[model samples]
Target chain A: MNDKITTPQTIVLIITTLIGVWITTLPATLAEKSGPDSWLMVIIGGGISVLGAAIVTSTGRQFPEKTFIEYSVETLGVFGHLFNLGLIIYLVILTGMVVRIFGEVIKVFLLDRTPIEVIILTMLALCVYLTRHGIEPIARTAEVLLPILMLPVIIIYLMIILFNGDLSNFMPFLRLDFKEIIAGTKATVVSFLGFEVLLLFIPLMQNPHQSTYSSFVAILMVSILYLFVVVTVIAVLGIVETSLLIWPGISVLRMTETAGTVFPRMDVVILSLWSIAGFTTISPMLFASAFGISRILKAREFKSFIVPLVPVAYMIAMFPKDVLEARKAVEAVSNMGLFYIFVVPLLILTAHWIRRRVLNR
Target chain B: MKGKVFILTVLIGASIFFHGCWNMMDLEKKTFIMMMGIDALPEGQQDKIKVTLTMPVPRQLVGAEGGGGPRPETPQQILQSTGNTVYGTIRQITNRLSRQLYFEHMTAIVIGEEAAKGGLDRFLDVFQRNKDFLRMAKLYICEGKAEDVLKMETEMEPLVVTYINQIVHFNSSRSLRAINYSIGKVITELHETNGNSLVMRIRPEKKEAVVAGSAVIKNWKLVGWLSDRETRGILWMLKEINRISVETSIELQTPQKGLVVLDLVNFTNKTKAKIQDGMPVFYINMRGEARIVEKEERIIKKEENLERYEKPIEQAITKEINNALQKVQDEYRVDVVNFGEHLRKYHPDYWETVKEKWDLMFPHVKVVLNVDVKIRRQGIFK
Candidate 1:
């Protein structure tokens, strides 16, 4: 407990802790149910996920010295270990799927000639190496690259504002019925799902008590940014164009005309920076998988596990034949795999709450 | 060290794949569209839509500021094509070009005055649909040859798009008139329930096609055009007085009448939907600051002129605005000002009961115009 184990800087940890999980399939899954209103789902989904985050934050505070893996075993015993393994397995698959999604995006949008396996393999290879470095380096990388990722986002917003942002795009507000909104919210709440990953890092943080607050702030900021992007894309591109286009963000990248400048195509700078953030996002998932497996195997250190798993992931990513199938597979992961994020966080809180009540009696 | 080497290798591999591909739109081979004009071909030519695209010839030198000089003598080279549809015309024109045209660089789109008056819905349909066109690009309805306005030279900007962009700049900065009439706003209005719209009117002023005013649209077609003065008046009603000066002359103490200009620096207009005597009534509340730019008579105290000038300018501005509003409502019968939308947003439920009958109720609906036009500052040493 007293050891100086390397952990993330508070801000980057908070951010990477959220984006590490959410960003990949959200743009695609939100598109599934609502078509254009998919962004609305991201916003609604973010809000619902906040509730899960609050519970995890409170529950993690109970065993400040323990990770969710340790605390779950303590709370639920041998059966709990089995349940924790199941959750870890779901998260590992999520890690695999994220590698597949980002690789597919790179293959389709950025590099058409490049094979999807080559792309996913390369990204997974990086992820395995970074995981071996431990969580602190991942957070440091996020800290360094987040600002660069933000510049293009700010530029896109200003471009929309200067050119004319159609407020009417959001008008006819609440166009979807309450039932659909609720359903959409359920599906999307997972888009904001990564906040619950805080439980896994409880032991790593120097101060677990207040980490939840940072998690909440990260969720709020991400939601706002998600809404900003969703609204901006829908406003400019309209519903039809937005639906068919593979990457809505890059389209906004291409839309901007640098008035009175030599440089015309600015999406290049944006794609390059976003790929770095993608690295931060993917590495954490792979790290989480390796770490979880280390505890399960009773290995000496989680770092030892990353090397062998890299090729396994690379081979798994190859299963998705192409970009379209890979994207569809990621969406399915978010849709079904979201239950893994939600159920575990909810169980810890409810179980903890009931335990507190019985103890009081 | 193995981890570092493997990680570097992966990053390099990924970079080689993504390498400079997403943002690549080569400028050298791309045609920079200067001006675009949309028109329905002449009578009996129902199958054809006329398009005039003005492109920069590179050698043509034009500038923006040279004291309103005569129209440049050079014959403006414009490519004209006719096709059954807007996309058809675009495709037809593309065949004539050596390079691909980039709609991203285009600044102004002009629909001829006749095409605007006839029906702009069919004409602007493609611009709204096309992926190539820019959202913020200015759209116009021309007074004459759709190509003539584009042919007009400027003293500063080397291209027509750059020139038209400058003329329309004054509108957006002040936040007047449908947030300065971008293509996206026009498209949005066409689709909105209340259906409010504006298209910048283009006419040859000096050597260039300066933005004349604005044309209002109802449901998707252009209903009426506004002169710059009338347009400013309409903008004031819509509460879009960004930083425009409203100048009118009147005698000061029986001295020779001088131009009294009120430079509206800022404004916020709120229109409300209310049931007054079982009738749907709209109340427009306007808050703005006016600055006196210039005057000819031996001026009284700048503060003293505030009282003397307030009532008349307000009345005059109000009268002009009412005329514009009436023309839009009573004659043209369009709610291009978005007074209806303001109500729909603020009072959505209340609007629902009246939504079905808003058309009949609108023209007769009592509009309570309450203006708080404040004179904040006067011109120095006038």
Candidate 2:
């Protein structure tokens, strides 16, 4: 929590977390609603995200070296623990949710015969293993996968677009009509949901200078990438086909074929590569949850404990009826996640102001 | 050392458990697809769509005398299956294969004129629905039997479908007969309002695939085909006219430059639809650079050439553009290029009132085409 020195670079925190959190699933899910205009919605959601990031970053600077949970105490007093406890619980829930959704998708598409519990446990195990390695391991993993993941994504996007897509599908341009377009932004906004995690890591930053700018840039890239996916899925799959499917982005992966060639169903490779994204997303949540418990309980070997705790996440995942129920369960928690993203910042700022006024007296 | 050990373990583990084909086919077993042709069987005879899948035999399989009929080592194979529906025929074909039939390699899809006219929408759905199918596969409306185009041999390339796919895509890219469509587009048009689609037409050459014509689709099914010239007109209204040719003639002062083909550059084509006293008028503005590609007579000086060629090229392109507008508006009676859609989005409330009449209003709608084509760059020859 000593933020007075040894801060993480703006680019490192921003790109590291951005690359880590942006697993393929979010955009893939959003494709159902936004269709060809999903990317535009990504930009729209991204813009809203920057404002959220700014509010969070500004509040963090006021507290000097303390992280968000620590500042929640200075702000809300007795309520600070309540805030911390809720967020930590939510984070654990989030880790399980990511693991569950990813496991189900892989189960249905690639490993239909594999038991869902086994799939969830295996993925959860990987997340726990990485959490034990700490933030630096996650960051290094992102660094390694960044070029490997992004270069191909960019190359594939350009190649698919060049092949031939019905521009007309995009044409009933902004075709959702205005009311639907605005409504579409809600879920699309959720996919770009990770910058809220920045509140936890601000103190760890080597140099928090221009952190907002780095975060915004990352959001912009996500928006553009999401938009590209939206456009491709819509232009290639059309609106109806896009909406009928649950994982629209995965469908896009299935379509990476060059006409008159032997290669077909390239999505399998994309899913394989995306395994890293999925892992990174879940690791942060588990690590933060473990870190929060350690802080609360004063436990040693906290990271090691999280790995064994994968069974707990696996158990929680089974509570949901199925994929549909699981998504609904996560969405219900979104109100709480939003509180963490927005409300906590304002609460911290209020606490700081009150603490300053009381101390001056 | 621990990290190294883990890395090695995972690498070996992935190889053992996930190294290959979690969701796809290996090369040996796949029935590779090139061209899929669908035609309706006549009435009660509607039991077969002369399905043809063209494949290439590698050089290794060529001219082997020791091989008995259709040797196992043959580089390529063309398999045909006849069934009632496109999906049905594909299934029948897959039954004959050792592995799944791969549609990712499909280059062009041909619907015989009859198939399209008799409702080919059902056939298109299977391709659209299949996750394994390539949306980028070029679509065509064939003039005669679709099997003819599929079965044709290639004079230049080994595979007929590859040659044709290139021809259609390349020319479409070049801004020639504007009908390059993916299956993704087909699905979209079938769903939305004022929704329509276009497909390229392919035919059999001595041994290669030829760009034959284009087809216009209405309500998910192909309605009619358009001439190559007409398809070019369709492109102008749609994608930006980047590098299309416009023919013109300039009466040279020093020497007569007769009919010349001008190459368009730095072009911008904008379409606007507005309610003028409660009537929708489409105003098209085109501004671009034009250069003389070929001329009956040549003037050496660049300045003189620019001065003489400017006015006629502008006039000719205006005429060319107006020609496209007339046909797209009147003959087709459908906004395939989405000009009306452009206006509707930017002006929603206004469109809501008059949207119903767009089809009725479009045919007679007055089109004002303005072209200000400037000559910025000419070839090295000029």
Best by lDDT: 2
Write candidate 1's Cα lDDT for A13-50 as tens digits: 55654553334344434544565466668766777767
Poorest stretch of ten by lDDT in candidate 1 chain B: B246-255
What interface RMSD do all candidates show, one decimal each? 5.3, 4.8
For all predictions, the C-alpha RMSD in Å is 7.1, 6.2
- Give lDDT for model 1: 0.65
Per-model TM values vs. the true structure: 0.73, 0.76
TM-score of chain B of 1: 0.82
lDDT score for residue B50 of model 1: 82
lDDT of 1 by residue, B20-71 (tens): 5555767778877766877777889755768888776554444234433364
Quality of candidate 2 docking, DockQ: 0.22
